[model samples]
Target: MPDPIYVPVLKARQAELAALSEIQPATRKAILPVLEIAPSEVDDPQVVSDAVDRISKKLEVWGGNELIVDAGFLSAGIRLPSGQGATMYATAKARSLGIGAIPVARLSDGDSARADVRNLQVEYDCGVAVRLSMEDMDEDPEELDSSITALLGDVSVRRDQADLILDLASVQGDIAVRGGSRIVLDVLRELEKVEQWRRVIVTSGAFPVDLSSVVPWVQSEFQRYDAALWDAIRGRRRLPRIPIYGDYSVAFPLLVSGPPFAPAPQLRYTLGDRWLFLKGRKNDPRGSEQFYEVCEQVAMHSEFAGAALGTADARIASPREHGPGNGSTWRKIGTVHHLDFVVGRITTLGEP
Candidate 1:
């Protein structure tokens, strides 16, 4: 494929990793993933070191050819125990595993982190990604130009060799959708004249922080407002380039959805414009075993895509046979199912 059909900005956790590792090869070829490496638990004293150690272990088995490694979730200026920065450590570990991972740099990053980017470009001659947040887009086009220049600083990687990412982060409500798209147009104005970008990707998530508003033991639907925001930009706004679509894949960017051991089982199945949510019986004594019942409901749905879709689908279709899996197992199941659904949409819907 000349260009990937989709970009999934996934958290580098066991659930997401397991999902990526299990997707069919054909589906895998269609995506360029942006793996957001998570930092260590806050309770840990050596978070910086722990972050490095964990990411190193994660990449050793990542098993992907191309990815955008974003350590934006890690502590900004903190140096690894090895005297390197987060991105530097991640890309190096990826290289050792023969993975063609591109390191990401942000305009708002600390001096040491930016310096790591320069070293990657100058010494390694490798590709780097420049990610700008929604606040960065708030700048006037001229001011945005200056920010990009300042971020590139000393060794100055060529813009044509770089991927420019405009991240909206999270969008909600109808008003937010409209406001977010406007910001996108503002940041993109006259940007092409500034430089020829290798690729432009816009990523955001709309999955709610929790399911408190949803009624337990009932099936409900929620809008994927992030996808709607991208549509608003693609159709309503006139821009120089069509950004590659990316999202958090059923998870929000900044918030945890709920406690891992919640009484009710949760099921999130993705469709194009909305998600089908099935919350288990809250007061049931079965607790997590309720997942089997919920999973069975999703599997039997008309849009389930059947067991042939992926590992998750198989487990979903035969929950008892697979065992009453925990939250992590269900996360992997839902995420893998989402991967199949999104890729299927891209291929069938044909450039939305």
Candidate 2:
């Protein structure tokens, strides 16, 4: 028998897990394909509007579902250095097309509009469902908690009302991948301490590692921690379901690409390590073609396809890959021409 005090928490977690199992399939169906526009594409008002129009049509062809437009690209536009202008534009455009648009904001990216309490207020007022990135704050749990609490306090909204995203790719350390699990668990624990914001989402970079590695590690950690907590309360050891309600998505950098069918190589390279090598046909410029192939492979292995792909048009601002094993020179990579292929693959994987 379990201690009466902790029995409620354990039962609640069990019920939540059971509910998740039933809705997992529908959750996959509601996945919002993300389209990242380049800074260059936002230079002209007409150009930005036209790009949004094209994206709307693409979403329709892809099954008329909602889309997630990364607002990071608006930072490059001449009229909208803050990126907010582009965000508003994308939101309005999606509404005009009779589809939903969710704008994602990275609070840490200097190029992205700073997500202060005031900005969040405006977002809330505009009826915009914004995704706030917490990658920069993962290193310090206390500070992360304060910032999140402050933000949520200002809005007075529940966790599910705010689309908070934790990017595991941004965690830094000697063994960053391994360390990422600890960082995520710590953050989740901190959030639970305050209030159980079960709807928080996780995302990962496409290169140097796969999101699959990070997601499973997180799930396992939650289960282990929950079990230990319950055992302490009940005076007996027993497994317990995870109590939180968050899920993870994958994001592929536009500049990074590889063969579609190739398995994700074990990503052992350290962050900031650069390298030059070819994984596909020699001289074949790596771009979106390879990205779609990789996303397809990832979806096939995971329980469901990712919630969204980080397609923001941005350069690999920092080094994410290591040099070739033999120590070779580096070269610049390019972008993918056909985002349609990427969307198609995601749609196929979302099917039953």
Candidate 3:
């Protein structure tokens, strides 16, 4: 049977409306980090933890679900309820204390500043940045070498603990491709799974989602997830380019600050142990052209702390290769331009 001439247009409009409809309810609501504005005198850990407990209880009463009571925000740039100042603490201390807030509002009041906040959240949430953190090496040169090695060891430790910490931060991990298989294709597949995973992340409260059902890569037998997620993604837009090569660009993925505030977690954590999935292609220097493009995309949009692609002569940070998925079995290995992308720099929430 022949379909109506307007069917395609109608279908497109329906998809647009569906995306918009998904936004309206929480569009105007501002989810801020519920914080404890403390006086400088109360820098004690026990004191802060107690205050965090109080704040958490209050937030629950006010319909808030998440809290980040970290000392980092004290020295970092965080606006207190007004006129209150304090010092930042270690993660142990920060975890003891509560930070962040969740404001349950019904609609946007059209305030320009609030609108700006929304924009910032969108930008920072997904924008990648070079993130730097100092670690104690050794006191002497001999010890310093070992110290640097020890510091690098922490990167692994942090990676291992990413899920737990990032979960508390309200961020999800993007699956990065690695290993001896068709790495690029594997990354694309993981990305598809990631997009599907995002629906579960943002709309989990409104809808139940099960990633395992949609993503063949995941094989857990006991994890129960919403099946409708696959349908939602299938109904959404698909990137025309799968093994997107050439001058293609993509939005730098971001990690959310925590639950009830951010959309998803950072790509680093999202990729997790799968970091080694891609095999590096050292023989072809031109092979890194695509990765360099990805790095440039991140640089244009993010505030990186110590990006390494600054030098063309640098070794491949995480080399990997792809094969067999698409036509032609080409072996190309390259490094992931080394850099630490900081997530949750987004100041505003709930905007396109």
Model 1, 19-118: lDDT tens per residue?
8778877678888889887766552436755765666676665555678888877666767667888788777777778677788988778778878877
lDDT by residue for model 3 (124-210), tens: 221111011111111233443343233323232221111110001111222211111122222223322223221111111111122
Candidate 2 per-residue lDDT over residues 1-352, each given as its tens digit: 1101101000111212222222223332444344455444236766766665555454443233354456565544333333446655655566566555455544333322333323543553322223445446444666766665555554444454455555443322335544544545555565544343423444433233343444311121111122222122223223121322111111123333354343322111111122111222223365323433323332333332233322111112212333221101111111110121222332453211
Q: For this target, which candidate reaches the highest lDDT against the unseen true structure?
A: 1
- Per-candidate Cα RMSD to the true structure, in Å, reads 2.4, 14.7, 23.5
- Which candidate order results from sorting by lDDT in descending order? 1, 2, 3
- Root-mean-square deviation of Cα positions for candidate 2 versus the true structure, in angstroms: 14.7
**What are the TM-scores, per candidate, against the unseen true structure?**
0.91, 0.46, 0.19
Pairing residues by index, what is the TM-score of model 2? Answer: 0.46
What's the distance in Å from true for residue 192, model 2? 5.6
Per-residue lDDT, model 1, residue 219, is: 82
Compared with the true structure, all predictions reach lDDT values of 0.78, 0.35, 0.21
Task: Identify the runs in model 3 with alpha carbons over 4 angstroms from their true place.
Answer: 1-40, 44-46, 61-67, 73-352
